[model samples]
Target: MQTSTIKLLRALVCMMLMNSLNAVADKVVTDSPVTDLSQFAYPVQDAKEAFKREQYAFVGIQLHDTLETPGVTAREVEVWSTQPVEPLNTRWQSFANIEEDRTALLRLRQYANRYNLMTLKLLKEKRRSDTMRYRY
Candidate 1:
């Protein structure tokens, strides 16, 4: 009876771990940062052109004088402050340029890595517990 109860508990734990990992994985896979064209229109358009051409270095160059125009930065900030807080993929905020592309991609990779690390940690704990259980 005790053995059955232990097995059931272990199964429950495994199920819960898998469910949590699945949620993380799902979030990582579907994560995409969206741009608000209203505020970031010109910058995004310029960045997209450079990005598509594979001239990443020219991204900043293209947006060099973007903020030189008065009220542009303030307008962007005002619009951004009103938007919902995003969990990830919001790169075009403070700095507006092509480098934000790299930042966004890195954020996605970070999420994937975090999920992998969590899974590994859980697996290591399970293995340690199983080995200790047998020794007893």
Candidate 2:
């Protein structure tokens, strides 16, 4: 009976440790597009041109640009926590005049937010897959 009880307690402790590890493994640290972009090297004009060429570039640029504005006192971290609607809308309008690169530009612009979202999602998923790979 004593041996059985000890085994049961050991099992319980193991189970608890496993659960804790799993919880930590499942955890993900996500920041706003603003902070994420700040870590990367962004060339505003090149990004804008990439928007015209790949259109997808716009997504990255838009987030970075929105975060980089001079007097927008809001935290980039906070701004990225939510879907950046106003910036997307504004970017959409900004490219409306340039007809030649309009399609790719718009497509890229439209995808910018999604790209950032996916990047965060991938990072989260990667954290789950490889706990050591992601520092956060």
| Candidates' C-alpha lDDT | 0.41, 0.42
lDDT of 1 by residue, 1-136 (tens): 9999999999999999999999976654444243432333343344345335533221111233332212123343343233321222233553443344554444434442443333334434655877899784
Model 2: worst 10 consecutive residues (lDDT sum): 28-37
lDDT of 2 by residue, 55-113 (tens): 33113334323432222224542443343323332344343322233443344444544
lDDT of 2 at 11: 100
**Pairs that collide, model 1:** none
Top candidate when judged by lDDT against the true structure: 2
- In model 2, how large is the Cα lDDT of residue 111? 51
Cα deviation at 125, candidate 2, in Å, is 0.5
Error at 20, model 1, angstroms: 0.8
Best by TM-score: 1
Candidate 1 regions exceeding 4 Å error are 34-136
